[model samples]
Target: MPHLTCTEACGPDELQRLLRPRSDVVVEEPDHSTPEDAPPDAPAPEAAFRAVDGPFHHYRRTVHVLERHDEECLVRQRISYRLSVPVWGWFITPLANRELRRPRHDGTQPFWAPAERLDPRAGQVLGVLCLLSVVAGYLGTLLSQTITFAFDEFDAGLATQGNTLAAVRVGVLIALALVVLADRRGRR
Candidate 1:
């Protein structure tokens, strides 16, 4: 027979064991505590929140676990009663069931991308490319101008004179603005 123990302050392993066999577990209320500041309308957090943390099958009510470590966990759940359609890659993209930050209706498990800290390589690359593009555009403008002046009116150089470093500068600025906006959106 398997037995269980709930220490005064239970750890993750202890909690896992408790959840293993039982679908639901109620934590005993802590006694002898007075609140320094308590909301009149809101119930005590311990009493109000029934935290169900384990290997969960997602559903309408389930929140997806965004980040999880040995002890710390970050979960994201859909905002109920709001069906928002997020746009991705220049098109309206509907998220798959796995992409949703919620539990599935079925009791099947789904694979997830484990959370790892982001590195700075992507930022470094984008900065380098922007610089290079600016330089290239400047050089192209100077070349096109010189060619137009030296060549005949009907020459190809005359046609490409509109393509200048100024154009490149405009394009680069637009791209940078887009990148910054995207980053801001991600942070929120």
Candidate 2:
């Protein structure tokens, strides 16, 4: 996403020039001005509002004037949100992000640039690496968690299992050493 999205021209004042206030949220209060202590050049929020109620109660909307050239001031609006509800947040967060990232009400175009497709060869390599990582992770998890069960089947003692686990840890360190060597070699 772009560092900041621009808004339409100012309504009447500096704060009004930021992102159009969200219709979905009930602002805690209309804090329409920057704090007095803020430096004049600082991109301090021209407007800041927190949602007073609902699942999006944690939403904090801030608008900053990045560049001001008479009537054509560049405004950047940021909406930080997280649902307070426990189970509902998992579902709502993604949906909210998708909705918020694009122009919701206004006819204006989305400021976010769409992602370009990866090269076919790069995509194939990524897929193979992802699959390999999953397999490796599963093998590691299974080995650590089920070592006792495996030893029980072999009729081995606790001391043997401890020694075996210690050996496996040392093997992992050896593998890590090889990875370090490979990384240094690849750089050349």
Candidate 3:
């Protein structure tokens, strides 16, 4: 089972109230059997919240309210998910599901900051340029090879085409770098 665990501070009553209204969450009866490792002062969980929707729909999550101190409650959440597919199931599903579970900070922001901040339009243009560069390079290589094979000799003109392809690749790279730099500067 793959799981994600995190702790949050909120009173048991408040947490229960919050979970009750959420459409995806189902509150469960608190488990009476406390772990021996748990502190004696720690309160039993008031209720367990099971998240029922999203990418990890097959998973079960039990939210536990561990303790209360100075009006703040410590909550522990345990999520368990199963990968039913064969072969690469365990490896790929967990990674894909985890990515889906991750909160997207980009939200309604004009720019997405996955690694470097980039406007959506700029990113799309950059992606197109990159794809074009790859296709052009591949076509250039195929043409050069075909020409070489047909004459049983390498042609100097083919070298020019290769150079042109390389130049285009470099130009695309430079353009992408400039866009990133400009976006970073604009942020300031």
Give the top-scoring candidate (TM-score).
Answer: 2
- Judged by lDDT relative to the true structure, which candidate is superior, 2 or 3? 2
> For residues 95-185, what per-residue lDDT tens digits would candidate 1 score against the true structure?
2222332223333333321132112333234345656778888876676567556556556563454565467668779988998999899
Question: By summed lDDT, which 10 consecutive residues of candidate 1 come out lowest?
Answer: 80-89
What's the TM-score of every candidate structure? 0.21, 0.37, 0.34
- On the 0 to 100 scale, the lDDT of residue 5 in model 1 is 19
Candidate with top lDDT is 2
Task: Estimate the overall C-alpha local distance difference test score of candidate 2.
Answer: 0.56
Which residue runs of candidate 2 sit more than 4 Å off their true CA positions? 1-20, 25-28, 31-43, 102-188
Poorest 10 consecutive residues of model 2 by lDDT? 109-118
